[model samples]
Target chain A: MHIPNGFLDAKTIAVTSAASAGILTVSLKKTKAYLEDKQIPLISVVAAFVFAAQMLNFPIAAGTSGHFLGAVFAAILLGPWEAFLVMTLVLSIQCFVFQDGGLTALGANIFNMGVVGVFAGFLIYFFLRRLKIKLSISAFIASWASVVMAAGITALELAISGTTPLIQSLTAMVSFHCLIGLGEGFITVAALSVIFMARPDLLKEKAFSKKITGLVAGLLITAFFAALVLSPFASSLPDGLEKVAHNLGFISKEAPSNFSVISDYQFPWVKNKSLATSIAAGVGVLAVLAVGSGFFLVLRGREDGA
Target chain B: MGHSYFDRYRQVDSFFHRLDPRAKLLWMFFFILVVVLTPAQAYTAFLLYLLAVFVLIRLAKIPLKVVFKQSLIIVAMVLMVAFFSIFKGSLEQKLLLIFNVTAKAWLCLLASILLTASTPFELLLKGAQSLRVPQVLITLLSFTYRFLFLISEEVSRMQKARKLRDFGNSRLKHLKTIGHIAGNLFVRSYERGERVYQAMLLRAFKGEINTYSDLRFMQTDVGFILITTGIMLPIFIFSILFTTQY
Candidate 1:
């Protein structure tokens, strides 16, 4: 979703960057008062959790693995404003330290994943909540809608930039995301159920049905444990992007880089795809927990003291 | 909690870091413009652009390894896209065009990374608001930056709990459990938002956000913008004058 500089025309990137910067600035001022002592640590830890969850990718079809974006989850826990801040921070670290995203496209990436994903997802949840939708059902619908909307926004941006044809890009992004959304929707619902069981105190306005929680917990617990044990055996399927790229006659468009540190994750002993992914996941979870958690505590403590 | 990294170095004593964010924004804008406007066939120009970014990377004292590493995501995307372009034309021509795209993108990435790394997120937002960016957008972005990590941490605890109890399952069942975990996360977040909003209302019950931070343009800011623009103007002119048909 992060549109690197060269991928977009000069005019497009310029206008988009300006637009994103403007929106983000206004967002900061509007929410300044809400950023209090308690909220700071809470938001940071949640962001770290999302960062960790993103590492555990489930294989789709052929060999490609698609990880959770957690956009809707962020918006759901934190407001859209807080979600955006957290995402920007996460992406900043990812780009500067880990090289996960391109620097030039940070604004665009924020626009797509951060802005569109967080706000749009929350909006859906808001509408659904207002309609007297049940918390569990609303979670499902909100999470699904957010993922789909984000994917749509991403595809639209790509089309506008002439990266791919309009319909083709939209179809590719949306279709694959739809499948991915199913996974997202279910995950969101299950997580909410757990919270309902453990911290029912958090559900002040939204009523939690214990019966549903038990049912969901029983089902999801069984499923999650199964995944942890069988994670390495998940199918290696081509994800939404790869499938679309292949079908759109752009399969051969890829070129090799002159230099890349972690290109393809090809190592000496980690020849197995699932093993490599697992290793990556292990490193990611540890990093997010150790570094992310430690960083949050330190920063929050300083801000509170100041 | 990790709010300071974006602006950590902005407070550091450096000529580039102290420049007004608006001025820095313009500098980054033009740098990207020059890079993007270059034709995909302009191989030399692309190489030159990379060299220029590399020079800035050195001058700014940013870690090269970090910048390059952060760029892997874009690199992967570029490669993925380029893979599709392999059949577009001759293998050699396709490679050159892809390289052109990749190199230009890399330079632009470095430019923005340096900007954010050097500036504080707060000041960056302040700069944007001062520039008349919409209040809603800025507010939303600020919250996003401010609370993302906290939300992530919450989700982590929930996952940890799930892991502790679900110690035994098959592959298919494991995926189902993972799926359920995601679902639960969504529900928990939705409920959390309600509490957070209530907490906010209790604090003010106001529709508008108020902030206290002073931002002013300094001579160094002007010098910084001028220097960046002046250095890159020739490259833009040359690319325009010697435009070649791809």
Candidate 2:
């Protein structure tokens, strides 16, 4: 869900950052070991295609549109590590060149979206397909589950960070994402159907062995669920910290910046705080160029650079 | 495929635009860490950071209009993200949480925007490569950047084709059309990837891509970092010191 900075505290940020970085390192090693040089472009291109695909939104309902996240789709086509790498790339680019996400919260955003979605998508598809479930059906369920799980994890992170209450946020997140998941499920199945009909051979590549993929997926899923189960306790633990927090009384986030006009308590020396944020708005348009380039390539692709 | 749309303000001459990419990258990370680690109660610190970044934005000489529009969307997205969570907390806490996140997120976005807006994509990648940020990641990121606009163009063209063909408004049909487009796009890009490899092989390409570079960490780079941290240190110190009140 692209948890912006200030949403997660230093503690949650550190944990998620370390965990996501570790997973990414292992993923990079796995990918390098598994694929040969000639075949590597497929991963890069698939990542490109996924990034492109995310931009093309389909109308879900009146006044609302949804786009594909493609984690499960990538997992089914390539493998989990490739899928993880692809999504992480997409997210990081979104964080860096585009202002779609927060740089500081990259780890948490990657953890919630990349790690959780990839593993969930890969595992569910792997197992369901083994159980002889239809490929399209397995894709539908796997993609759906991945979205829901990612949403749940995102909400939990928000709760644990003291940004939101767990239960309400969890319910809202899960319920809202349940709709989003339906879009994911349908698109995934349909996208898989494309490969099924046109280029099914892409699926058979040995991105990783079946046993190892399963094992890694199982471990990551287990760890994710463990963190999910334990995090609430950590936040609400009757330990000295929570007691100290309660004692301190809200620790009062205080708007975190001088842009605290909404609060009764304003930061000192801010005569017109609301007007000051105009100064803050000075850095977010490149994504629009990326966003606008879809139209330009038709005219510009003939002569691009070295 | 289109490099022209990559960085609109890269052509603009300014101090930030002229600094080393590695230095700017460091400034970004350091600035983000300060934003992230500052206690949420530290309003003064956030303001200070925002002002500093704004100064750089001014020095970069980029148009403020583009930056402002981008940040508005980010703040709105934050609001959308917090819609569910905001209802649970007290009025003060809820307002504080949203504003805090908006401020911190806005600050990080500006810095990143500044980084990308000021430097061309190629130089940025070259800087990251020199930083040794996993050769594979840089490679993949470079590939993604190159093909990003092309794939997007393909998808848009397909959308146009679908519209031209009178693909009816059935939601079911809509999903299938997108699936078909994606599936079609996948095969297209995949083949392009294969051809790219062949092209690379023809050029005596090894596992790594070596772009010619002339990046060096100059005195300005050092000055930028020192000045950033110089301003940052006291705000950070005073903020933590102020946190003792809570």
Question: What C-alpha lDDT do the candidate models reach, one value each?
Answer: 0.58, 0.72
Per-residue C-alpha lDDT of model 1 across residues B41-112, encoded as one tens digit per residue: 556666776777777667667778866765565657776557545423346655655776677777777787
Sliding window of 10 residues with minimal summed lDDT for model 2 chain A: A277-286
Q: Report how closely model 1 matches the true complex, as a DockQ value.
A: 0.13
In the order shown, the candidates' Cα RMSDs to the true structure are 14.9, 11.2
**Model 1, C-alpha of B129: deviation from truth (Å):** 2.6
Local error of candidate 2 at residue A259 (angstroms): 16
What does the i-RMS of model 1 come to? 9.3
Candidate 2 docks at the CAPRI level of: acceptable
Model 1 scores a TM of 0.61
For candidate 2, the TM-score of chain A alone versus the native chain A is: 0.72
Residue range A35-97, candidate 1, lDDT tens digits: 543344345445545665675465565676567777766666555666777676666555533
